[model samples]
Target: MYSAKEAVSANNISEQFISQMTIRYLTSRKLVFPTKSILDEERRINSWLGIGACGSITYGRARIGKTVCMNYVAESIRNQYGSREMVIIWNVTDHPETERNFYASILMAMGYECPRYSTALILKERVLNELILRAHETPFKKAVMFIDEAWKLREKDFYWLMDLYNNLSGKDIQLSVFMYGTRELKDLKHSFKLQGKDQIVGRFMINESQFFGIQDPKELQFCMASVDKLHVCMTDYEILSDGLVDFYFPYADGKTFFDISNDFWEAFQSVRIQKRIAAEDIPMKYFIDSLVICLNMHGKLGNSPIAFPTRKELESCVALSGYGESDDEYTK
Candidate 1:
């Protein structure tokens, strides 16, 4: 009877240990690394908002971190200039197929009281008037509007947007517009070539940044360092080991945690060099997702700690991230 009780207790402890080992303390969503791509976008946005009466477009492959870059830059700008002075309106144009919907979306993001009963033309005027009114205020000096998923914009929507841009600039409202989308934005701009949409085409073409991902070696290193800053830990071990520092959160590579910087960068290079992954194929989002997945996989391996991602595993993560197939290799 005593032996059986001891056996049951041991099994129970084993189950609890497994459960604790599998717990992931970090996620990609929580940590937004300011890589080169993000920094470049930030600079462009700052310049646009700084001068006023201009707009910028950021387009790239799917899951390339364009939206994240925009959000991070906007937040940074807002922080620098208090909330009252710098207003950022974000609208994800998922199904905003009409002009009124676009206006309503912007108004909604700005927290304005938009009546549903109003016509699309009224909504457009309302948004423009609101911007004009804010421009007159002492506290409001700059307003930035971010329209994500802008590839869904139709030809009519382009005219509507151009008109809005013209109206806002005409009022001298100090407005900076940013559109985020996929490569389709380029196709849309091309369509306007002989269609007499020169104004709209010129506005976007003037200040456009193409974000493919981190391609340069130095930039790659910087990205790895940014990942290190996240400092994902084994929370279960932190609690289980009590006050002992040594037993708390062993390195994923079984070495020092900082080794992840080189390990991740090297693994990525190997995959790309072998042609298993292309340079353009590895975007910021996939890299981030792969890192998070690798970290969780390492944490799950109870005693065996493999520090960095294996090529196969990394490739698999990229595949799962929806950017598996190489569309085109980035050229110098």
Candidate 2:
């Protein structure tokens, strides 16, 4: 196994980058902030039973800390539980988003051969058996399943996850499964009872779920402080507490910490890349707007450029962004 540092330095934004970034992102004593409250509840879970399976919900909204909290939890679990423990993050956007593909990934991560078959149900059953076998046969059998962007998962995928837990229950296999995303999973829970709604209302940390909320002001400060040293350059972090954090607090009403932290890091890195600047002297809004221009033009758009946007391209990018025009701003 290569060191995570060496894995990150190598080309490509592989899972290693996600792992590296996750550690840096979550460990940031200052920048990652606190609304998650995830770390606390996770401690109460039983490693063997996965009693506190982080629900398969992302807590989608505007300012919620879904992704940020998951990042923290993933690192914490990795730190606490050794690397031999399985920690796989299945992104719905990047994969086939089907039950079969999902289970195949699980099989692959578990170090068990993925059966060459089309039926997910079969693979799911076989994998559960594998988990049991691995736990009982091995002395240090600790495995964790991490599902990110889980809200986009189809119903079949969700049911199988529940079934996997249900089958593994009462065994000493020691499974720690955490699902993170947005309101998408919460809504699905209305009809499904994997963890059961009673446990939630009754105050028991039932079903391995640790719901999060807006971070506290202290956590906010700590998070900002922590990330400042790890990444290139960042300054003057601001939280739009008034907007989504407050106004949209309900109905999975927050967008999680991804938007804010992503904004901060991208802008910070841009400052480092664009011009030779003193670490202390970062133009906040200039860097932010330029960063946004890159986001608008390069990211989700079709046939976008490979490199990040330039200072000159930003003006036209912004001007064309509102009009739903991509060509005028970032075209060849």
Candidate 3:
């Protein structure tokens, strides 16, 4: 069992290794796109899970696929452990604004009953008691509590986390907390110091994974290739060997998927060049949306031997969809 750092450094990926890795580990009954960032985040979470009862934070602006990446990691961990029962992943995305509601959310995720009008103390007790019971009776002894939208947590809510952390300490069932939020999460941390909550801040600082959009041309290529490798449900054909760029309606000349991917990459670069946006300005959401739109367009070719978008069609879709818009503008 290699540490996360060891695994990341050891599995350093190059273009040559991606195909092999994809065929061996990523391909299954469903599509599992493995990029460098996704793999690195998985390794870090796995390492923290092994160590147990720690905290990690993944923060970036919205639409960077932070939650999506975490979902992949959670599913991968459950599958690798051979039993979903062995690892419980609770996503607290719509968690309540209050502490009691927060504890209620955790209790509900664990299937613990919390009667109406239950006090915060009672809710906390129920959660801790259930965790302890699971350690002894259930096969799953480890848990991951994901606090998405963590920036929404108020100052008093920090103590709620501290209480949960303290209660879980010295117990057989180790837990790891992952905080997912935007840049404001760090500001929340800084405000904690003013409130003299250094310990809570320290707990969350154990590991920080910075989520990002496409940062370079290489990453853009990697992401596009990952999308290109995405398997369609209908056919048993191998896109890796034969792509649909030229074969599809927009370009019936039958260019390869790699060729199509190169075209998509160039379109993004073209946006940067023509719009004068920074080289790294492309957002992950825009890429995802563009790919989805292209796929939907390709799906229009029902029962066709190949399904893909031409360079011209892809460029048109991305531009029309406003994928090249700046993050602030998109957010607004």
Worst 10 residues of 3 by lDDT: 233-242
> lDDT values of the candidates?
0.61, 0.46, 0.62
175-239: candidate 1 lDDT, tens digit per residue? 67788887887667667776877887776556777886766667666766554443222323322
In order of TM-score, best first, we have: 1, 3, 2
Could you give candidate 2's per-residue lDDT for residues 1-332 as a string of tens digits? 33323343553434323433433432343444333355554453334224444333334432234565666666666656455344555555656667888788777766667768658888877788777765554354555666666656665665566666667765645555555665556555554455465533222123445354423334433443432333211122222122212211222233333334444444444443443332322222232233334443443231463333333444444333232121211211
Would you estimate the TM-scores of all the predictions? 0.74, 0.46, 0.73
Model 2 segments more than 4 A misplaced? 1-58, 62-65, 93-102, 108-122, 133-142, 174-176, 193-217, 231-332
Q: For this target, which candidate reaches the highest lDDT against the unseen true structure?
A: 3
Return whichever of 1 and 2 wins on TM-score.
1
Measured on C-alpha atoms, candidate 1 has an lDDT of: 0.61
In model 3, which runs have C-alpha deviations exceeding 4 angstroms?
A: 1-32, 86-97, 111-114, 134-140, 228-231, 234-254, 273-281, 297-310, 324-332
* Candidate 2 global CA lDDT score: 0.46
Residue pair clashes in candidate 1? 252-307, 253-307
lDDT-best of 1 and 2: 1
